[model samples]
Target: MLANLLLEIGGSMSTLGAGIGAGLAVIGAGVGISGVGGRAMEAMARQPEIFGKLQTAMIIAAALVEGAALFAIVVCLLIAGNA
Candidate 1:
């Protein structure tokens, strides 16, 4: 029916979209953390004396990025639940 086509009922597209978004957030977070770790290690290798400071800074940066990603994932989950 035209109405059925125009107005979707029991649609799962929103849920699917939200799920995809959440997955992307997690993937992005993983990539960000990996980059941070790799770069921090590379910097430390270049200058071994500053390893402690570099490591501490890297941890803080990674935690902030991860926290943001977690927030995004939680929001996506809530949206999925609502859908």
Candidate 2:
């Protein structure tokens, strides 16, 4: 009985951790993308001639951040499923 109870608790904890990790990953990605956009806009404002380059760089950076977040979320879900 005790073992079963412990096992249940462990599973719950793992699920909770996975959820938290996924949430954090999403939040981090949002922050990263925002920062990239903000910086790119600032740079464009300061140097209008480089707007094209800045926009391209910003999009690339945002995409990378999103990809990482997606990967993290998938890993978290897998962990939760296993748990």
Candidate 3:
């Protein structure tokens, strides 16, 4: 099913794996950032005085997740191109 579709579209196992890896990376990043945001909001609600600190931490965590996702996507693209 899904494997057959990926095979037809990617033409090689390496490409298919790369595609799946890239997608998973992006999805993981999204989940990570959302969790950071949601938790930050909850913390801010509980301790309004520390809102600024929570915001800064949230931004940093989100940036790290985004950077890792971008790196994963680039590696996947390289693998796909080479294949």
Q: Best by lDDT, which number?
A: 2
In model 2, which regions exceed 4 Å deviation? none
Put the candidates in lDDT order, highest first.
2, 3, 1
Steric clash count of candidate 1: 0
Which candidate do you rate higher for TM-score, 1 or 2? 2
Tell me the spans in candidate 1 whose CA falls farther than 4 Å from its real position: 1-10
Candidate 2 lDDT tens digits, 12-60: 9999999999999999999999999888888988999998777888899
lDDT tens digits by residue: candidate 3, 3-80: 889766766888889999999999999999999999998898899999887889889999999999999999999998
Better of 1 and 3 by TM-score: 1
Alpha carbon lDDT of residue 37, candidate 2? 88
Backbone clashes, each candidate: 0, 0, 0
Instruction: Give the alpha-carbon lDDT of every model.
Output: 0.89, 0.95, 0.92
lDDT of 1 by residue, 15-63 (tens): 7888899999999999999999999989988999998899899999999
Evaluate residue 7 in candidate 2 and report its C-alpha lDDT on the 0 to 100 scale.
100
Q: What C-alpha RMSD separates each model from the true structure?
A: 2.2, 0.6, 5.5
Tell me the TM-score of each prediction against the true structure.
0.86, 0.97, 0.83
Between candidates 2 and 3, name the one with more favorable TM-score: 2
